[model samples]
Target chain A: MDKETTIYDIAKELSISPTTVSRGLNDHPAVNKKTRQRIYEAATLMGYRSNTFASSLRKQRTNTIGVIVPMLNSNFQSSVLAGMERVANEAGYNLIISQSLETVQKEIANAKTMFDNRVDGLLVSIAYDTENVDHFEPFFSRGIPLLFYDRVPEHKKCTSIVIDNIQAAYKATAHLIEQGCRNLVHISGSLKVNLYQERLKGFKYALMDNNISFSDACVISTNLSVEAGISAAQQILQMDPMPDGIFVSNDTCAVSCLKTLSQAGISIPNDVAIVGFNNDPITRIVEPNLTSINYPGEEMGEMAVRSLINYLDGASDVAITNTITLRSELVVRASSTRKGEAS
Target chain B: MDKETTIYDIAKELSISPTTVSRGLNDHPAVNKKTRQRIYEAATLMGYRSNTFASSLRKQRTNTIGVIVPMLNSNFQSSVLAGMERVANEAGYNLIISQSLETVQKEIANAKTMFDNRVDGLLVSIAYDTENVDHFEPFFSRGIPLLFYDRVPEHKKCTSIVIDNIQAAYKATAHLIEQGCRNLVHISGSLKVNLYQERLKGFKYALMDNNISFSDACVISTNLSVEAGISAAQQILQMDPMPDGIFVSNDTCAVSCLKTLSQAGISIPNDVAIVGFNNDPITRIVEPNLTSINYPGEEMGEMAVRSLINYLDGASDVAITNTITLRSELVVRASSTRKGEAS
Candidate 1:
């Protein structure tokens, strides 16, 4: 690395006071326009870059937002991040992102790193295993605004942005039943996650509304990965009475499971109707295109950053808004439209 | 925002000199262990988060790497970022990312932000219209290591990690020819980008080798988006002598084109054989299973970061390794196999 040129170096080279150089670089009103121009030219000639770290020490503002996500390799998360980036960038804020790889220990470590970096605010979609958020105490105690999206924790000090998972799930389940499904199975992610737990509730409620008795065998909890989908399919195949319908937590798993069941000679929507959450692109390509919930990932992300920035800039009181629910809708596709209906 | 606690606040509360508090905070050996413990406890009570900005001012190191990508909403780029995060986290470094939105202006703005942040190193996949890299002069002049991947510019001061686009394209084109394709259409991205230009060259070379007549109309330079695929398919349908095969730059575009063609009563492999680059998950899900080049995005990302870190740490001279080419393979699937061969 090359030696960084400080304001002092510019001052010494230009025969000016270090204070004047610093003031000029900062565009202080006290500095003369001509003198500032000279300082800038000299600094540019020396390749003197502004040390944001040093400037932030005096200003107590970094103009950087910290973002911690569950994983980066997902369509939903990527869409959310793209939305966050658009809002944050337009507002002249940089986003520093970290992934927890679905573990609490890593989440804590990531939170610590964000705290150490002194990010102005934090946006988090916490890991699946992050049962509690004692690690985020520093942000609360120090009055750093934190907003959670998608997968969130309930806290008085934080604002959460999410879609109504239960309503979406209920719609999906009821749609499957309307398509002539009798016995149904719901493939869920870790029930520890609020979204999955709420989805489980919706599935039960839908069954009850249809006068069908639900049992423990109706729910299959897994990690909600592509591989998990295959195993869940195998488990479903071994059941005493086969499920006529299946609803999965994510499209990746749903698509995989659908393929496996089809390879086993099961006709989609004839033998089994399927519904998946998160209308990812994979849903469109899969044969008998999977029915899915249109999770508002991008909107949720925009709301998270906008709320945090609002709180930071005193434009609005994010504290009063405990949770902001974005709209989610069921996208009925070929996978669930059984009775000779077009997708 | 709340008031931040400082060492001076601790000193005043504990009735000790500010120097003692500062030393204790730094874990200085000169400070007594008992006083250090007391200071630590008091600091915790007061939410005295360490100001890394101030510390970095003295240390002249931030342990942060800046990454600039074309787009975040891409399957290939997401996989790359996942790999980058894994390697950077293990190396005890933080990643700050920005997207160019496939524009040179945004790319320039992102570069300035990274420079102002004083990142230890930078990794960039240049934007679509990035004709020259004069905007990257600040990093170049400051001698901060800059590494490019996938999309790159010819820069003497930088290292690039990329796959052999020409070889991958050649293999794809040759495979289609082997399957009895008389005339082929190449759906390419902006020719301004080196990768697309190389692929175009490969496409032309394969046609010349097969003794087939080619025209400028045979090549379609597009944005390579899903919408672009539909438009390209329309163009193909209007050709005087319809091309028997197609090779698209990305899978998203390829799948859309295939869907459009199929909906228009065009048969796959029989009417048109197709191949795509970036063997994304969508390739497998699409009907007839798109044939594509397995571009090693994760490996490229890992190699880019590893080289930049190696350069920053003085472990290796990335300058000597101007360009590092990772392995790429043509995964022949049903889309391009017209000779009744299995995938």
Candidate 2:
């Protein structure tokens, strides 16, 4: 391997003092613009790296933000990541990203790695089964900024960004009821997650307000995968009375369920109205155009990054803010619109 | 901020030599398992973080890999990232990720950031408008391993992992021809990319082999966006004799085109049989389940990271191999299956 070029090497080549070269490289106003440009060209030509390692040690900042997501491939998470990358990049910070794969153990491991790496701040959307925020205690002790988005923990010290899942679900369930759906079922994810638990609450509240009875049999707890949706549809088929309305937690599962039920000779809206969460592109591609909650995934991501950066820059104290709630809306489509209902 | 704990602090706390503390932290065999466990517990109690900054400077390895993609929110790119993350995480490396936003300028800026961060290795999927590989010249000059996947550049010095786009396109087009289609149109992305250019070649070759003359008018260049697909469908509707078969470059655009055509009173697989590439989940959700080429995005990502890591680990020389091609298969479904045709 070749030896790395240092500012001292550029100083010698440019016949300038090492301090002048360092100042020029750092763009300290002490050096003129022309001299800085000359120093930059020399550095580029000599393959001189700016030595982020040394600078990070001196400044006690890595200029890197750590992001731990539940999964990387999902539509909502990916959109959130895109928004985060845009904000972090524009702020001259790099993102160190990892997925927990929906396990608390992996999330703990990922959090430890981010801490060991000395990331300036962290943005996390925790795993599905994470019951506690104890793993992040080290960050709080060190006074590192930790902000959670989407699936967040109920921690007073840590700030969070999220949409009102309960309101979104209530709107979806109400729309289905207004479409003349009598017996309704809610296909939910793990109840351990607060997001899904709140959604279940919304479902029950909507039913109670509409003079309909809610039962444990009406809720199906699933991982909310495509296969889970197919199985849930099979379960729906075996019901004696049958469900006239269905509110699924996500679009991926809902689309698969819709397809399976349609193949089984179920007429959409006319026989069974359906509503899904997360207005993913799949919602539109699916037949009948699924009604869903626009969860504002990208906006949540952007807000998370912006808040963490602001706290880090001392422009704002996110710790005092506790939580930031973004707006979410229910988009009604043909899937939940019966013959007499407006889409 | 409080001062960071050091090995000396741990040594003093445990009544041991700093050298012994370092060996225990590094898990050297000289330190017994019991002593190592004690050292770990003490280090944890004192909130001692391993100084990766100083260690990286001494070893010239950051234990980090940089990844640059055209966009972060796309289904294909996210899947690739998930695969990469799985492999890299198991290998004990962090990923610094960024998006180029489909511009050469942004790609260049991302490459420079990765370089400045002194990443041990880099994985890139070039932007749509990137015409040259000059931005990566710094990595090549420094002898740092750089690998490309999916939308790769034609550079001899860099290794790339990709699917055979030409063969995949040939299979898709040939399937449409076998379904008894005479007239055909190909939806394509920017020809500047080698991947799209090769697909165009395969589309032309398939027509030539089927005794169907190819013409410039048969190709509609697009960004492969949903809006572009709708506009392309409008253009197709205005043709003198509308195309009987269509092969789109990606599922996102193809599914949109299919929906637009379906809404315009055109029957799928009867008026115009359609085939798309990158068998994304959306393909299954679309009406008349889209026939597509199953591009292995996750596998491609895994291969790219594995190859680069292998090269970095001195286990194998990826540069000697140049390119690794993964297999892609054509999945025939209702969208491209005409009456009496086996799907």
Candidate 3:
């Protein structure tokens, strides 16, 4: 925060004129490379910081990007943020991040703030239930590059980065069937989200493909929180014949369900098998390591920032690209294996 | 990213000079409130934004604060961020956050970037291995307010927000002792950080208070990651008689150790009462809920930002107030109670 060292300081240190130091630093043909190197060295030694505002006034670029995420507390979201941070930092861009706390109102406020700050581009992973995107009109009107990652909305002008949730879900459900589960249940998030809707579709399709009845009653919709997991397990316990297999949309809920069932004297993989999504670290620490879909959260984050920067630098036109899908794999563990099958 | 609207547009629409419009926006005593509200409404309609740089030319203050953390992927750090964001946003100040990724080199680079960005105030939670504070000379020289939270360094000019880690650890260790744990083992992170160091001291004091001689062999230093928990369990299993009690610095590692020990046929509570820190949601979902310290991460964040803003606005001086300690408590649960004493 101290006063930025000016070219005069550099010249004074080197016994030269301010003009020569500025020209040298700017790489003018008139100044030799040796002189430029000397000027740069002196500037660095004096802790001289380039006047970003003066340069921004002339070049109209800040070399900074803005990012808005729902929250940074979750393992998946944090992985994504770490990925974005690495790519942005390596590319000589700083990331200014804010969380919306899963509210549309807060998301709008964050968008307005980001706009007022004059960020060159934006990367966003939207809140839980964002019904309208009119708040982003200013960015669209100005043609500023905008990209979305996980929890994306259906927007044509904006590019999206995500994994194929449907395919991952299908593989997870099919793994349950391969373990000899005839009756299975899928615990889904709110149907409003495209991720959950697609995952539910995959679950139903897998059941149908195996000549099993895909009943609407088999799917349980909840917030997918740990408490929701406990409630889901309670509901399962009350059934005439408990579910033989369970696939949850997230790990937090699955862990809670597994704990509750174990407490009620239910045998895992023998009487019931379980699968969860996101491959969160908790999946491995549970009593029976949970089988789950390995979401590429970090990779998705890295890709989102990399793509946005590429578009900003004219290395690529991401707007023409609709969706970038990353790979997701099914990780089989003890929770969902009845036959002790190798994965 | 678009051309910013200025007071000139508002003045042109209202048939007034640009100077009068600007003065009205600044709430000049000469301008009536009705005229000021008119200008504000017109500015809003015209999509006008206040230029902090132009205003700072007269006021010498920027309505922006910078935050640097070691990483964004931890439960504690994210909770702190949520609290900071709520306070900073409510005060109409923007926060530019960056991660150090637990390296001193990255910390220095992040500090330089924050300085270059002309942040009005800075909040830092120093990296694990930052041996020197020279990187912060720029902020210190200019009388900029610098505050530290959580993993703070021993700096005179900076104010820090933290909990009594020693007391929290003492309490946790005392609880384990009360549960009849004689030979106790403390699983700790590297002793580089003050929190870990203080917690180790408290653990030693608890053992001494209980007439148990502290042995260096009972302490295991680790990265405190989930992988560390697995390896630590292997080491513990090789002990002469295996410690009767285990206390871990973090819940993630504690839960992993519990699972690994259980797999090795060691029953929790009955065999080894376990205690962990940071009452994360995982504590409840584990077979026997983990006993942990409920550290006030959100409150700590809010307090740090609030104090920084207070210092910036001349409402408080961080130089005089060196440290602010928040409350922390041990929440006893099933994991550390074999004889129902915790109840």
Candidate 4:
């Protein structure tokens, strides 16, 4: 690395007092405009960096926001991050991002790193097996604003931004039932997550409301992935009476199931109906299209960042808002429209 | 906001000398273990931050890296960032990321933000239409390590880690020609980027090597979006004699062309062979599957971060290795296999 240009270098090169150069660089009004301009030009030529760390130290604010997510490659997470980058950039805050890779240990490590970095705020979406957030105690104790979005856990001192997963799932399941599905199956992600747990509750509630008795056997709890979807389809085929309908927590998995079933000569919406969550672009391209829950990932991200920045700028109070729920709707496409009827 | 706890707070709470408490916090040799423990407990109870920022100001190293990318929502870029976060976290450095959204103006703002933040190093993938890199002059002049990957520009002082786009495009085009494609059309992104420009050059070279005359009209320069692919397909249909082969720069656009052509009753491979760059998951999910260039996004990401960190650690000189190119291959699938060859 090149040696950093010090105030002494700027002072010597510009033939100005070191104190004057320092004051000019710090934007002290006592420095004359012409002298300040000369100092600034010399500083630019020497590639002098502003001493922000010193100011941040004095103010006890890092001017940085930490973001932790389950993984970085998913479409939902990516869209959310794009929105976050926009809001955080506009608010003059840098976003330090880390991925948990869906592991609790990694999440803990990310939390520690973020805390160690002295971030002014933190935004998190918990990983699959993250049962507790003991690692974030430092941030909480320091009174740094902590916010959670998407796969969030219920905790005090943490404001959460999420859509009503239960209602969305309930509407999806009810739509499948309305499509004349006699026996239905719900392919879900790990039940440890609040989103999946609430979604499962909604699925059961929908089934019960339609005079259908639900059992633990009907729920296939797995890591919602493409391979898992194929395996779920194989499991459905082996049943004594094949499931007439299937609803997966995510579109990637659901599209895999649709493909696998189609390859097995089971016609979509004719012999079986399917509904997926997260209205990802894959839903539109998949054969027969897919019915899914239109998750507002970008909107949720925008809200989360906007709220965090607003609180930081003293424009709003985030303490009073414990949880902010966004709107989500079921997008019924051809995949679940069995019997040529609206579901 | 809660008031930040200071050394005075810990001293007052523990009824100890402020100097002694500060010494304990700084791990001074004079401070005994028992006294240090007492200071630590009081500090924790009072929510005392370590004030590393102050220490860093004196040391002149912030231990932070800045990263700039064209877009954050793409699968390839996300995988790259995931790999980067892993390496940076283990190295005890934080990554402050920003997206240019493929605009030069945003790229300039992101650079200014990174500069103002006083990051230790920078990693960038140049945005579309970013013909000049005046925005990065501060980092360049300061001798800070500026590493580029993927859509990088030609710069002497910077190290670029990228796959050979020309070679990859050559392989893809050759595969189509081998499958009995006489006339070919290369659907590519803007020529403003070196990557797309190289790919286009390779396509023309492949045509020349295959004894087919390359025409200016055969090359369709576009944004390489799904919408662009639809227009490309429409243009192809209007041709006097529709091209017998098509190779698109990215998968989303390739899939779009495939869908549009299929809807127009043009059978893939049999009527017009199609190939795509970037073997994204969508390639496998698309009907008949897409033959594509197997670009190693994860490996490229890992290499980029590893090189940058190595340069920072003094293990390697980036100037000595101006450009590091990774390998890319053609993954032949049903989309370009007219002879019924399996992938």
TM-score, first chain, each model: 0.89, 0.97, 0.95, 0.91
> In candidate 1, how many Å is residue B286 off?
0.8
CA lDDT scores, all candidates in order:
0.89, 0.92, 0.87, 0.88
Chain B structural similarity (TM-score) per candidate: 0.88, 0.97, 0.95, 0.90
lDDT of 4 at B263: 92
Q: How far off is residue B242 in model 3, in Å?
A: 2.5
Give the DockQ-based CAPRI class for model 3.
Answer: medium
Stretch of 10 with least lDDT, candidate 4 chain A: A49-58
Give candidate 4's TM-score: 0.93
Fnat per model, in the order given? 0.80, 0.89, 0.56, 0.71
Residue-by-residue lDDT tens digits, candidate 4, A264-343: 99999878999999999888778888999999988888899999988888888888999999999999999999767645
Over the stretch A109-218, how does candidate 1's per-residue lDDT look in tens digits? 99988998889999999898888889999988877888888898866677889988888899999999999999999999999898899999999899999998898889
What are the clashing pairs of model 4? Answer: none
Ranking of all candidate structures by their DockQ, best first: 2, 1, 4, 3
- Output the worst ten-in-a-row residue range by lDDT, candidate 2 chain B: B334-343
Give the range where candidate 4 chain B is weakest over 10 consecutive residues by summed lDDT: B44-53
Top-TM-score structure, candidate number: 2
Error of 2 at A318 (Å): 2.3
By DockQ thresholds, what CAPRI class is model 2?
Answer: high
Clash count of each predicted structure: 0, 0, 0, 0
- List candidate 3 stretches off by more than 4 Å: A1-5, A9-15, A23-47, B1-49, B56-58
